[model samples]
Each structure stands twice: as C-alpha cells, then as structure tokens.
Target chain A: MPTPILVVDDSVMARKMLIKALPAGWDVEITQAGNGVEALAAYRAGKAEVMFLDLTMPELDGYGVLETLQAEGLNSFVIVVSADIQPLARERVKQLGALAFVKKPVDPAQIEAILREYGIAL
Target chain B: MNDQLLLTPDQRDALQEVTNIAMGQAGAQLAQILEVFVQLSVPRINITESSSIATSILQLVGTPQSVTAVRQAFSGTLRGEAMVVYDQNGCRDLADLMGYEDDIDRDSERELLLDVGNVLVGACLNGIAELLGAKLSFSAPTIMAEDVEVGRLINPQQLTWNYALLVEVHFTLEVRDFTCHLMTLMPEESIVALKSALDAFMENL
Candidate 1:
C-alpha cells in the first residue's frame, strides 16, 4: 500500500512547491490542506501518515496542529516547512514532536534527505 | 527618547535576530517573484515617537521630489503597520525590470508598487509572526502618497499610538538599479506584548 502524505499550508504557491519537491517514483498518495483545521480534519479521517505543516495560517496553525496531535495521541509523523527560519521556531517545533523542520522556498534535496532520515524509501 | 531605551541589549539582540531572518525570507520571496537578486541591509530596530517615523525614513532614503509608498496594517498577537517606500526613479527602474513598457503611466506604477508591497511586506510580517509564534492578519495594501516628501506622507493624527517600535530594512536590486525601504511600526501597547514574546522565544532557545 502507498504511504499517505498530507501537505498543509495557507499559501497555494507553497503547497504546490511542496508537492513538486516530492521524490520521483515514490509510491505515495498526497493530500493537501490549506490550513490547520483542514489538516486536523484530514488527520482524523486517517488520510495521512505523514504531514508537511506550515506555522502561520488563518484558523489553527502548525503549533495548534501539533498540540492537538499530542493531546489526542495521534502518531502521524510531521515535518514542518515554513519561511519562519528562526532558531526559536525550530526548537519549538522539535519540542512539539515534529520529525524535522525545513525552511522555505522548499528545496527538493532537503525534503528527500528528511524523508530518507525518517526511513521513507524513495 | 527614553522610551527607545526600553529594550535591554539582550532583547534588542533577539529582536534583531528575528528581523534578520524575516528580512532574508522576504528577500528570497521577492527575488523568486521578480527573478532578480535582492541585496538586503542589516535590519535596524528603534523605539521612538510615532511622529518621528517619517523623519527617520527620510534620513535613510534621502529626500526625493516624488516617491511611491504602500502601507498595510497587521493585527493579532502582534500588531503593526508596514510601509514600503521607493523614489520615483527607483519605482520606474523596478517597473522596467518587471517588463513594464518604456512609457509606464501612473496606474501601472501604482499597480507595480502594490504588487511588490504585497509580496515583500506580507512575507516579512508573516516571517516575524512565525518566529514569535504569533498569527497575524494584514489589511489590504493602500497607496499612501505619490510625488511628495516622504515625511509628509504619514498623518500623525491617524496613528493609533503615541510611541512606535520601528523595524527597518532596505533592499537593493543592483541589476535594475532599484532601491526601496521597508518599515514596520509596532505601537507601544503592542511592544509590551512583543517584548514578552521575545523573552519567551529566547527562554525556549
């Protein structure tokens, strides 16, 4: 069975960039959410095993999603992708149980490396 | 101004670090959108009377006969107004680089100004908010003035605060010979919240 991946961000441009960065020939189904509320809904529906989350959005944000996931004990792997590249941001996301943090404008190599580190085979 | 000294060295340093990262992100986004290399200045942070913002901006960009400016206000956990200013020549040069025809008119120039403002100001504020772990919403960009002194563009009476915390950064496009300034003005009430937010961010680090 293909792995299910959820990409969440308020920016259409950012979401498209994340999708384009996925490794070639990866057998995965991709789901996209424009904000954290949608992301949580998708998560609840078992639509994603992995998520790429952005920190700032309209409704719930990346941190809110992480908090919700932790409160509910959801075990989905999360990799935060955001333009906010401050050291504090990285630390907070790590503390929130994110698998990794990647800065924006998304780099395909970085995404591949992160997926590899998480043992997601290309 | 005594109020300018409200931030301790450590707090100022932390704010500067956040501003630098935000400016970098904004520059990267602008570069991608315009297909040009954007050179950014070190961000400068200052607290001053709200009335002095225009004077400070003039000191940085010099007094020009005509200029184009865009302002957007943001509110949420952090609240501020961000403005982008460019001299007439700078705006013309930028429009040319963006593929505007040789005879660009006032309407086209205004459109160009707002488009750049939306990209740069929006990204920079979002970057800052992200760093502080706050969410912000921005008003639509408004063209404040054209063909006027930079200092005269802002109306003191309209500002909601007596004191302002200013985060300023400059961007230069060498290839296009265009330069512009971005200024974010956080009110005194907002600065209190910002300072606490900075402290929290630093403690976590």
Candidate 2:
C-alpha cells in the first residue's frame, strides 16, 4: 500500500510546487489541502502519513495546525515547507513535533533527502 | 528626537541580516508568481520619524507621479505597514508580461498592483515575523494610489508610532523591464520588542 502524504498551503502555486517536488518512484498517495482547516480534516481522516505544511495561510495557519495536532495527540510526522525560513520558524516547528523543515521554493533534492531520512523509500 | 539614535549599530546590523533573508524569500516567491528571474537590489535601512516616510520614498523613486502603490498593515508583537511601489511604465510592462490582453483597463491595472503587492508584502512581513518568533495578522492589501505624490499616499496621522524603521528593496525583472520597490515600516513602539527578539535570536545563534 502506498503511503499517504498531505500537502497544505494557501497558494495554489506553492501547493503545485510541493506536489512536483515529491520524490519520483515513491509509492505515495498525495492529498492536497488549501488551508489549516482542510489540513486538520485531512489528517483526521487518516489520509496522510506525512504532511508538508506551510506556515502562512488563511483560517488556521501552520502553527495552529501543529498546536491542535499536538493537543489531540496525533502522531503523524510533519515536515514544514515554508517560505518563512527563519531560525525561529524552524525551531518552533521542530518543537511542535515536525520531523524536518524545508524552505521554499521547495527543492526536489531536499525533499527527497528528507523523505529518505524519515525512512520513506523513494 | 532623532529616531536613528534609538538603534545601535549592532541592532542595525541584525535588522539588516533579517531583512536580507526576508527579501530573499520574497524574491523567490515573486519569481514563482511571475515566472521570471528577479534581481534584488541591496537593501536600504532607515530609522526616521513616521512623518518622513513619504520623503524617504520620494528620495528613492524621485517622484510619486510615476508610481503605483499598494499598502497593507500588520500587527502583533510587531506592528507596521508594508508598501509595494511600481513605476507606472513598469506596471504596464509587468501586466504585459503577465499576459494581460492588450488595452488593459484601469480596473485591470489596479488588480495587478494588488495581486503583486499581496504576494510580495505578505511574504516579506511573514518572513520578518517568523524570524522574530512572532505571529502577525495582516490587513487586506489595498491600492493606495496610481501616479500620485508619495506624500499624498501616506498619512502621518494613521501611523501608530512617532518613529519607524524602514527596510526597502528594489526588484528588477530584467527580461520584461519591470521594477518595483518593497518597503516595510516597523514602528518605534515595536522596536523594543524587535530588539529583544533579535537579542534572543542572536543568543541562540
């Protein structure tokens, strides 16, 4: 069975970039969410084993998603892929249980490396 | 009171470092939005009274009559406004590059300005806030003026603080001959918080 990955971002352009950057030849089913509300719903529905989250969004943001997931004790691994590449952002996401942080414009090689590190066979 | 005196050399350097990273992120996002390579100019930092903002902008663009401007305000631990200014001719060239049909109307031009402004200003401010470990709520971007004086577009009474820190950068799309300026104004009241945040960030580094 393919692993499910959720990609969340408010920008259509950013979401498209995330999908394009996914590792080739990976047995992965990708789900897309445009904001944090949809992201939470997607996660709760068991549609994602891993999530690529963007910090800035309408409705609920990445931080809000992380906080809610933590409160609910959802154990899915999160990988923050954001244009907000500040050190504080990286630290905060990691503290919130994100497995890794990837700066945007998402680099394919970097995504592949992160996936491999998280034991996803690419 | 000279607002410049409020920031130490170290604080200025730290602010510049943060601005550079933020601008880089903004540039990358902008390139994706426009499907072009963006050339970024060196960032210019100024600490001055809020009333002088228009003067500072005028100095950079020479005259306000040739530019279109968009403004958005953001608040949290930090509070400020971000403005995107594009030369009138540059705005038309950008619309052309974006594949707008010939005979672009006034409404089309305003929409284009707001679209670009939202992307660039929102990204830049979000980047800065992230660096400071702050969450900011942003106002909807609005087109302030089309070919008006910089002074006319800025109202001192609307500023929340008497002084501000301004970070400005110019982006040039060489292929299309499009150029625009992104300016972020952080008010004096927020500088205290910004300085403390920077100190903590530096300490962590």
Candidate 3:
C-alpha cells in the first residue's frame, strides 16, 4: 500500500484545492480531518506518513494538532498550509517540524515542487 | 482637529473613483478564481459618522440570522479598515463550489472562512495598493457570527475621526447563486491623499 497521507483543514474549498494540486498517480489514500481534534484522532488511529494541515481552526487548530503529533513522537511528514502569508506563521510551523509550507489558492507547480523535493513519486 | 480637514471635495471624488476601480478588480479576481463569470456593480460611496457605519454595512450585506464577517486592516499613505461580510450559509455554498464534501464541521467552517476572507480581501487590498502605488499588509482575519455587533467592534479611538467615507460594493457569485458585499472605511485624511493621487494620475494620463 502507498503511504497514507492525511489532509487536515476546516474549509472544503481548501481541501478541494489541495486535492486538485496533488500530482497525478500518487497512489495514496487521502484521509481528511476537519480540525485539530479530528486530526489528532486520525493520527492516533494510524500512521500517516504525510499531512497537509491548515493553521487556523476553532477546535484544535493546525498548531495545536502539530503539538499533539509531536507529543506522541509521531514523525510524520507534515506541511503547514494557510492563507495568511505571515512569515511568523511559517517560522513557527517550521520549528514545529513541518516539512513544508503551501499557500492557498494552491498552485499545482508548488505542489509538484514539494513532491519533487521530498522525493515522492506521484 | 476639525474632521472636515481630513478630506476636501476633490479628495472625496478621488476616493470614490478608486473604490469603483477596486470593486471591479475584486469582481474580476473572484471570477478568475472560481472559473466562472461574476457581476459586480460599481460601488456607491457615502461619508457618514462612524456611529451609523455598522447598520449601513449590515443592510448592504442583507439581514441574515447569522453572518460571517472577515476584516483586515491596511496602512500606507492611506490607512483604513476593509471588511467582507457573507452569510454563513453562503460560505457553505462557496465551499461546495470549491469542491468540499457534503459534510462540513466547525473546524472546516473556520478554514473556509479564512480562505474566503483571504482571497476576497487579499484581492481587494492588492488591487487598491497597486492603484495607489503602495504596499499593503493584512492581519489574520477573524470570523464572527451575526450576533457580533460590527459597529461596536470598530474602535472609535482607532478611527480618530467622527466621520468615515464608506464604500459599498455588491457582487454575485454566478455558479453558487449567492451575493456578497465588501465595505471599506477610511479616515478623512486618507481620502484627501487618495484624491490628490488620483488627480495627479489623471493629469499624467
């Protein structure tokens, strides 16, 4: 089975854009969680090698989810996704061990670049 | 300070013109992102005391039992507040257009609100900044329900003026069958500068 990647965000629009941006033939199952709480539960249930997490949420936001994952010592390949292009959010997420940062209105080219950089064949 | 000093008649006219162009650009940006045609009427401008702004803006967005509003502040030669208000139901409709699944929870709602706010407000500010030949920065958008009193939310002290120039923009999302509005408020001083800038640009052309 290909790596199980988790997609975390509250917005359906954001998730749709993420799916569209993913390279074709990734050969992976994408599971989605609406908020940090759901994402934390998803992480605890199974190991997802990769996650695309949104930063701002009402319950267990992106940062909270990252912290939860870290506390459990799960070393998933995580990426921080947000519409707020503030550098502070980026630096904070990077410190939390997110593998990458993707801005919304997700561009296919950027997704491809991240995939290439991470050496994931999709 | 006399609040009237903040804007001359020419300045008011210039700000109106700028807002007209800005709304058009915002409409175009939305259409491009949604991959559908959008129709946005030229915005109407008014200068009124700050006390009445919230009621006026709310009326334009329509009376919904629940509304989700996104606000961002920008500063430059012109400093002001910009808000995009939509019915929460409208947001879900937008989510559907963006391809979100049928079920959307609270967390997803927040994310959707942020994305919606980002694109719409970002595009609006970007257009205005470009037109004014200035750089703009925005704080993270906060989403609130209809119960939130918008007028009270705007700090009177921050305004430093008794009156504000309000720009009301009405727009339609063709695919989604929803209408939204963007309201922009700026200090009288900013209006003065904008007018001078517009007049200068016009003379140059």
Candidate 4:
C-alpha cells in the first residue's frame, strides 16, 4: 500500500489545487479533511505520512491540530498551504514542526519542488 | 493601529490616494491571474457607519446575485481587513481559466478561492504597503457567505456601529461571465488621515 497523505483545509478549491499539483502515479492514497477536528480523526485512522494544512479554520485551526498531533506522538510531516505569507506565520509553523510553508496562488512548480525535496515521490 | 487617530488631515488624503493606487494594482493582478481583460472602476472612497458597508457593497455589485466572499486580515503600519467578493457564477469562469475539468471537487473550490483571494487581497495590501514605506502581512483568507445584513460582518469590538471608511471597487471581466467587488475597510479615524494623504499625493502628481 502507498503512503497515506492527508489534505486539511476548509475550502474545496484549495484541496483540489493541491491534489492537482501532486505528481501523477504517486500511488499515494490522498484523504481529505474539512477542518482540524476532521483532520485529527483522519490522521489517527489512517496514520497519514504527510498533511497539507491550511491555517485558519472554524472549530479548531491548523496550529491546534499540529499540537494535538504532537501530543498523540504522531510524527506525520505537515506542509502549510496558505495564502498569507507573513514571515512570522512561516516561523510559527516551522517552530510547530511543519516541513514546509507554501503560499497560495498555488504554483505547480513550487509544489513539485517542495514535494520532491521532502522525498514525497510519485 | 492606535496611531491612526493621530494622523493629520493631509496624511489622511495621502493615505486614501495610496489606497486607490494600491487597489488599481490589485485589480490588474486579478486580471493577470484570470487571464481575462478586466475593467475596474476607480475606487469610490466613503467614510460611513459599518452597518452601511453591506448596502454599499450591494450597490456596487448591483442585482441580487449570490456572493462568494473571501476575507483576510492584514497587519503592519496599517492594520485592517481586505475582502474579495465575487458572484457565485464566477466560480465556473475561474475554473475554466485554470483549465480545470468541469467536475471539480470540493477541494478544488477551496484552493481556487484561496488563490483568488490571495491575488486580489495580497496585491492591494502589498501595494499600499509599498506606497507608504511600510510592511504589511496578511492572514489566510476565510471564506463566508455574504450576509446581506452587514451587521454579520462587523467585528463588534473594533468597528461596532461606528463609522468606517470604505474603499469599494467593481470589477468586470472583458469577455468572461465573471464579475466581482473588492471592499477594504478601516476605522473612521483613518478616513481623516486618508483624505489628507490623498491630497498630498495629488499635489505631488
């Protein structure tokens, strides 16, 4: 079985773009979560290896989910996919143990670069 | 944020003019992203009660089409919220522009909206930041269904029922079926400073 990857965000469009940007034939099982609560549940259920998370969400945010995941001792890599590219936000997510921070207006090349750098092979 | 109250009238006008220019750049960026010819009306500046913003936005959008809104908060030398509101129908146009298939999933919608909001809002805020010799950082956009009742959009603590200065812009794509509005809000105090800023900018021009 391929590695399970989780995509967490509140917007349907954001998830779609992220999925589309992924390398074809990755043989990865991509799961979706609408919010942090759902992300947590999906993480626990699937033991996902990577998570593409959005920062702002109602009823639990990306940061909260990361903290919870840490508490649970789940070591999945987190890649923040957000429109806001504030240096502080980048630092904050990095401190929280995220693997990468990709700003929005999703660039396929950037996404590919990050995925490859992270060894997320297709 | 508190410093907005201290700005002189001249500073205010310059600020407003700066916002106008900033919005113009943002509009251009939107056109580029969508790969459509966009006609954007010069922004109209108004300082009025927060309750009136929705009405103002509706007036700008015209007709009762469902609105798809994305709001993001920005902070730096100037702190405020920027929002991009598009007609629900525009989604299909955006999807087509991105070359996505017709059967786009929920995830695709979120990503597209985020990109849309980022281009419009980011460009506007960044434009202002550059003009003012300040740095601004934006938060991720939060999508919401436009509440015709403007009361739903206000932050009770920051704006309450007090006045806000609104910079509203209307956008029309040349050949596409997409149409939208961009509204930027700031506290009433900023209006005075913004007006002054505009005046100075004009004098220099």
Backbone clashes, each candidate: 0, 0, 2, 35
What tens-digit string does per-residue lDDT give for candidate 3 at A1-122?
Answer: 78788888765545655776788878888899877898888877774678888775557788888787777785788978775354555677888888888865467888788978988766
All candidates in order of TM-score, best leading: 1, 2, 3, 4
The TM-score obtained by model 1 is: 0.62
lDDT of each: 0.81, 0.78, 0.68, 0.69
**Across residues A77-120, which tens digit of lDDT does each residue of candidate 1 receive?**
89998756556567888998999999866789999999999898
lDDT of 2 at B48: 73
The DockQ figures for the candidates are 0.05, 0.04, 0.01, 0.01
lDDT of 3: 0.68
Error of 1 at A115 (Å): 20
Best by DockQ: 1
Q: In terms of TM-score, which candidate is strongest?
A: 1
TM-score of each: 0.62, 0.61, 0.54, 0.52
RMSD of each: 14.7, 15.2, 18.3, 20.2
**CA lDDT of B68 in candidate 3?**
65
Model 4 lDDT per residue over B1-117, tens place: 334444454444345445555655666677667666565454555555665666666566677656677888877655677777777677777788888988998678878987888
Runs with alpha carbons beyond 4 Å of true place in candidate 3 = A1-122, B1-14, B62-65, B144-160
For candidate 2, give the DockQ.
Answer: 0.04
Q: Which digits, one per residue and each the tens of the lDDT, describe model 3 over residues B77-136?
A: 777877777764677787777777888777786787677667777776676667667677
Off by over 4 Å in 2: A1-122, B2-5, B63-65, B157-160
Candidate 1 displacement at residue B54 in angstroms: 2.7
